[model samples]
Target: MYSLLQRLRSLRHGFWYGVSRRIRWSRGAFEEAPARELCNVDPEPAERIAALRDRYQVQFELGMSAATSRNNYEYLDLLDRGWSSLGIGRPSGGVLCDIGCASFWYAATLQAFFQPDRLLGVEVEGHRLFRDGRARIDYAAGYLWRLPNAEFVVADYTRCLLPADLITCWFAFLTPAAILAWRLPLSLLAPERLFPRIRHNLRPVGLFFMVNHGPAEAALAEGLCAAAGLRRAGRWSSPAALSRYRMLPSVLSWWRAG
Candidate 1:
């Protein structure tokens, strides 16, 4: 019943949050943003899973959301915001780091979509998610082998140092703070330290983009942004705009180097 209670709490949160943020929703926001492309990969899960196995020589599973992502325009829509929000016009071969990049899907997908100079996906699990840590790393490395420019590392961001021209964090709060509180609360409470690291590593005038799903989450993110001394670039609070990008009560905030 602990699980049931959790689900109930989640449902309640979604209901209240949706009602409170209803004013921001609009279909027009989606219409106004740049167009998005649908997923081009085969619809069959077996086919896709097989492809990963053959390429990486490991048995890996993709979350239902990410597996079906390409079939719809949602993923591309999110990427559209990532690109437009950061003001990345063309590929200048800049470095991009995705924090808490689990399963390496965002890192891999965005790498293919944006073709940046280099892409770094940092996760705490490393390769241990699979049979052993090596398999996971091998899977990530092998998957991006052709890309050559993209690399994956298993490490905690708060304890480690990482630099990038563009840094992104998406839906990280989905993971319960309790699970992360002991290991690295800074990532949850105050990621100000990461701000300086990004500033130090990012190219001139680099960008940091953060998305949080609800008011509560946005509050935490804002605190981190302030602690990091990040200058707000822009925000998308409109309901339609947030929904179009699959963000919840979402605050799409970006920061530029001061």
Candidate 2:
């Protein structure tokens, strides 16, 4: 009975996924507009912002909306903490790829923080259209059109061809429950195969940074990376809450390819 129910759910989700993909493809790409505003959230503390600037030597710009501004600050804070905790310095110039980047929402923040010579946001579902408040827009296209050095590709990360000096993956699905929660087909859950591909695409001594939802996910992710032969460089969990959301604390970990 359990197997039967799971099959039924997969069939239902697969049908919807096909339908959505066709609709998005039919719409084609829209003219790049101003990036959309994210959902409303409280702004980061002013003192925290000052601290991030001092530590990272980076500046923040006011976002198109209050929510966007707040999100920008949060991302910066997260990256600052993650890098510092890992004892890694900012990269001078190299290719950086962000895997499973839903909408590549934080492209600008990444560009500023890493200052990479090239930045790529790779997503399996690249054709997903998002309403950016003004109009329906293709997130990847909009970012590609606006950011000169950034590129967005629609492809499976496991098969990505470009080698990267730095890779960032935020909340990659590692369990069937997590995949189903996102309405993705269970077959897409492949952490066993995914970690090795991530390691394969990294240049020698490249850095792979990941953020897991909570302690459980972090443990699973760390184990998978270890099984794939990636060396753990550092791990950290923020002492103070960073976002207004009441979800579990995000755990940041970094690995190096030998």
Query: How many clashing pairs per prediction, in order?
Result: 8, 0
TM-score (all chains, Cα) for each model: 0.58, 0.83
Query: How does model 2 fare in lDDT?
Result: 0.74
lDDT of 2 by residue, 1-102 (tens): 237767678777777666666765524334433334333323556667667657666443433344544566678888877777666686657999999887
The list of candidate 2 runs beyond 4 A from truth reads: 1-3, 22-44, 50-63, 129-137
Candidate 1 residue 69 Cα shift, in angstroms, is 4.0
lDDT of each: 0.54, 0.74
Who wins the lDDT comparison? 2
